[model samples]
Target: MADGLLVFDGYCGFCTRSVGWARALDRRGRVEMRPYQEPGVPESIGTDAATCADAVQFRGPDGVRHGGAAAVNALLDTVTGTRVPTTVYRATAGLQERVYRWVADHRGRFPGMTPYCESHPSECAAST
Candidate 1:
């Protein structure tokens, strides 16, 4: 089963919204949602709490882990109303990490963001 593992912050309202968005747009049923805050979640990705803390993570069909902007870019490939940006995103990979970092650092300015960012960020910074 080639699943798209979507790692998110269980406590964040914005992160929850992103999960819902993924479910709504993921008609292919390829994405799996997991909250990094859970006890066994990080182990699933072979990562530690500190490393996984600030970003959303994705494990693709190959079992390769992708975090930060790349993970978000990968998610966009399968989600709706996200294809266009995905293309643009591909062209701007050089800047994606920086962008994600900025958002992660200051996400509180945006409402519904606390769930994912009392300290860090990753809300579909990946895709659709």
Candidate 2:
């Protein structure tokens, strides 16, 4: 079994692509990726739609929930088998949070960023 669950805004192209990259790095299958829009996902994670809509979430093996930059750092730790990312994240949390917020707010503004709903209309129909 995976060490944690990563809940992300699957509709966002950037988010989806980022998750794909993370999966690639997670050769050990340390994390399970899930779209927050999937049925019962947010509730199962003990979070709500609005909370998930705001930022990505990570539920660690210990069942602690982390959001936004913290979640990303935790995921990096799991996938890379090191605490380097966590150290960097903690050292630069303010800037990291700002950057994460900016990226989240403008996820669709980047070129070639097409949301999953557009790329896979059929599969995302219910979520949309």
Candidate 3:
């Protein structure tokens, strides 16, 4: 399978940890995980910083972009080599989106999760 790109917030510990799990699951190295904060990354993906900040982004081998819960489903499908994630996501689209949004909004509140901005104030000062 061609490599797929998973764009996420590097500043969010929760998001970073979640990407770590996804990396582990991608035994075939089929997915490329990139932080949206990286210079020129958002532009390369045909998106902008604000959109990426709002939701996780996935660009599959076919070059189709998926966001939020759809991004997660696409990543899972790529790593697992099954349609199950996509199937389940389609079945519960609304609920999936709501849950994803809630988690994203409260990601910093997760236990032991410290956003990069909080730790490195100077580095993230301009970005925020």
Q: Which portions of model 1 show Cα errors greater than 4 Å?
A: 78-88, 113-128
Find the 10 residues in a row with the least total lDDT in model 3. Answer: 119-128
Q: How much does each candidate deviate from the true structure in C-alpha RMSD? A: 7.0, 2.0, 3.0
Give the poorly placed runs of model 3, Cα more than 4 Å off: 112-126
Q: TM-score per candidate, in order? A: 0.74, 0.88, 0.87
**Candidate 3 TM-score to native:** 0.87
Question: How do the residues 30-119 of candidate 3 rate in per-residue lDDT, one tens digit apiece?
Answer: 998877777777877799989999999999887999999999999999999998999999999999999999999998887545654555
lDDT of 3: 0.85
| Pairs that collide, model 2 | none
Better of 1 and 2 by lDDT: 2
Error of 2 at 77 (Å): 0.4
